[model samples]
Each structure stands twice: as C-alpha cells, then as structure tokens.
Target: MVAGDRILMHLQGRSALVVGGTSGVGEATAERLVAEGCTVVITGRDVVKGRAAAQRIGAVFCRADVRDVDAMIAAVDTAADLGAMGVLVHCAGVGHAARTIGRDCAYSSAHSLDDFRETIDINLVGTFNAVRLAASAIARTDPDELGQRGAIVLTSSLAAMVGQTGQAAYAASKAGQLGLLLPLARDLSSKGIRVNAVVPGGMDTAIYGPEGPSEALRRAVSDAAIFPKRMGRPAEFASLVVELLRNDYINASAVELAAGTVQLPR
Candidate 1:
C-alpha cells in the first residue's frame, strides 16, 4: 500500500483512549479523533464534566484519575472494548508555581515538599501509568500490513526546557515526560507501537481559568512569541496531536508548538 493510504487507514474504526479529555487540549483531541472515524474513550476525574465533554464530542467517558493504576487500566479496557485499541493520548497534568526559597529568606519558607511531590506524581507518574497500560492493550491488537499496531502521543510543555521562576515542580514533571519518550519508543518498537510528545507553550486553555488570564499576564506571555504574538489555540494543539498519531515515522520526537518563543525568567 502507498504511504498515504496507510496513514489514512490508521484512524478509521480504531479505538483511542485520551487521558484528561474532559477539557482543554484533551477535549479537542478527542473531538478530532471522533471526526476522523475513531471510537474514542475519554478519561477524567470529574464525572459530570467528563460525561458532558464526552457527550459534546460524541465520545465515551470513563471516570479515572491519571495517577491511579487500576483506574487507567479500566479506561484502557473500556477503549479496547469499543474497537481495536490503537491510540493513546495522555494530556493530563498539573501546573505548580512555588519558589525554592521564600522572599523572607527564612528556612521555614522553603517550597512545600508535598506540593512538589503531588505535581510529580500526577504529571510524570501519571503519564507512565497511561502509556504503559494503554500500550499493553495496543500491543495485543494485530499489526497492520505496515507492521504498525498503534501510536501514543504525550502532551508536554515548553516549560520543561525554559521554565520561569517558581515553576520548578511543573517544569521538572514535564521534563520527566520528555525523558521517557525515547526509551518508551524503543521499548515498544517490537510491538509496533510508537511514542511521541508535543511541547506546547502558553496555550489559551482553561488552565488560565474560566474567566481567562489577566490581560497583563496574557500580554507578557504573548509578547515573547516571535510571530503571531498570541497564545496558541487548543485546536492548534489538537491538530499536531492528530498528525503525530497518524504519522508512523514520528516516533520518539518532541515537537514544540511554541511560535519561536523561548521563555525567559520573570
């Protein structure tokens, strides 16, 4: 078959599990997957919002926390039951902002260890949880004529490379995901499962809150972009995610979605 034909066949009738699909980039990705003719199951911790988002996008909702092993396995099983499990997109993560030292310069004013651990557990460990469980299901699926069984796309952040002040925990966790990409792709190669990551920068999403980010804050971030001079849209993020999952040769790659912007310390 021609390469174009192979790419077109990858999504149709396939089953995809998208972690953090209740909102933001994950919701957008799930919607795009459905439009591409894939059966998608989205997972989130909130039952109401999860169900609502699933309904809005014509996807199935599974209430599951990214950090929970059993919960993620159940989500994978749910997707597998929908069709041949072939896609896993992990978009779940938390952002934290706390400096290593407080302005008071007191020893007691150090960054909260609990907060750092929670961020790492949810962002880094949760990514592994989703990838490992989903890969197992995808590996079981019969490989295609091109020896491709499935694809996995992980959502990372440019902060991993250029974190601002007070973003140590968030940056470290996202960096961990990037660290996992290559080894994960290698380990899953024999099973015909590809792993890749998207490093987005300053996307306009709910992470900024329902009312959106303050004008000053938004302008500060947008000003750093080399061109377009605006934050990225979730749909733009979704587009890259779909491409990564469809393009079989993009394994282990970390594509930055920043508009030529290199974040600097505040």
Candidate 2:
C-alpha cells in the first residue's frame, strides 16, 4: 500500500501547509498529507506549476515566495482558513555551486556575494519566516488531548553535515536550519508544538535539472550510499516526513535519510 492509503490517526481532519510544493519532495509530502486526511495547502512561486501540482494531489495551491514575508503570511492564512493548522513542512530551497575562490584564484574569479546571500535568504531566513507564522496559527488552535498543538518538519540537506566541493553556500544554509530546529522546538514546547528536520542525501528530485542527473553523476552519488547503493526516492523521503509528524516523541531532532552514507565525494 502507498503512503496515501494509511490515514494517520493524529492527522485526520487537521490542516497542513507545504511550501515549495510545486514539485519534488514538497509535492510528494503534500500528496502524503492528503492521504493522511489533511486539508492541505501547497505554496510555490510558479502559479501554473503550483496549480497543476495541487490539482494532481487534491490540495489547494497558493502562489507564494518563501523569501517574501507577505506572501508566506498569506499562504499560512490560506491553510488556516481551511481548518486548524496542525502540520507545516518547509521544502522550499535552492542549491548553489561556486567555490569561494575560482580555479583561476584571481580577485575577479571569486564567488559572487549576491549568490550566497540569495541562498541564505531563501533557504534559512525563509524557513524561519514560514515556521514563525505557521506556528502562530497552530498555537491559536486548541491542543489535542495530549496537549500537542502541532508539528513542523523542515527539509535539510546532507550537505549541511558533509559538504562536497562547491557546496559552501548550500551547506551553510542547510546547517542554519539545524541550528533552528532545537531552539524552535524549545520555544514552542509551552505551546505543545514540536520541530524537527530531515537531512536527505542525494534524493531523486528535479534539483538535478529538467533532464535529471547524468548517469555518471548518478552513479557517483549512489556509490556513496552504504546499502541499496542508489539515490533515495522522493516517496521514501515523504514517508520519513509523515512519520516525524505522527510520532510525538520525536522532536528537536535531525534524522538523516542517507542509507548510512556519511561522506560525499569531492
């Protein structure tokens, strides 16, 4: 049976919001949430893709950029309007590949400061923005019998812990997410909300490009895995996400979904 076939007891009739749900891991997670009986709202910057994804998964589409405060707030409001907001999965982020100093080692060949800033803004700052706003909406809802109000799951990358060459910006941004998980969970403890993160490695997603990763690149990354020797499926990642949301005991933690792969090739 697929993830959608199982309706999680805790999530039934609850509402959820998935940022960057137009495709990839976000889309997969949103689909699973619908299966678990959530009133789901998905947000993306592209209207056409966002609408199509939402329609495909039985979710509402909201066009919102993660970096924009007004847009994120509007997206949260849209989810809250459907029902009590109980789950938030932030999957919106970008990867950058530029060495601090180019191979030429010339001043003109240095990495662009603007690129680094953009990655941090969207991946790190945007995460905090969405979490804060969505947590507020969730806190407003009455807690469950267990005194649990809601749960949040953030998508962090394996690069955060073991960054490969040209991954400085991406790694730092994801690491920043780890920095937020524990503190945010602590801050929301009184409100009965939990925060956690999924650190995925080499997932099969569109981040590779429209054509996907080349065979050589795929094998290189897959070889890094300890078992099954392949990149992770988006559905597999989605499963962990729902599990984290369902298991109340698991909080303020970062779970790695890398098949025991701890290091990345340079």
The 0-to-1 C-alpha lDDT of every candidate, in the order given, reads 0.92, 0.91
Compute the lDDT of residue 199 as modeled in candidate 1. 98
Candidate 1 lDDT by residue in tens digits, 135-246: 9999999999888999999999999999999999999999999999999999999999999999999988888778777788789878899988898888999999999998
How many clashing residue pairs, candidate 2? 0
lDDT minimum window of 10 residues, candidate 1: 1-10
Model 2: per-residue Cα lDDT over 1-266, one tens digit each? 44444333289999999998889999999999999999999999989999999999999999999988898899999999999999999999988898889888999899899999999999999999999999999999998777788999999999998999989899999999999999999999999999999999988888888887778877877788899898889899899999999987899999999998767647
Residue pairs in candidate 2 whose N, alpha carbon or C atoms collide under 3 angstroms: none
Question: Candidate 2, residue 171: CA error in Å?
Answer: 0.4
Task: List residue ranges in candidate 1 displaced over 4 A.
Answer: 1-9
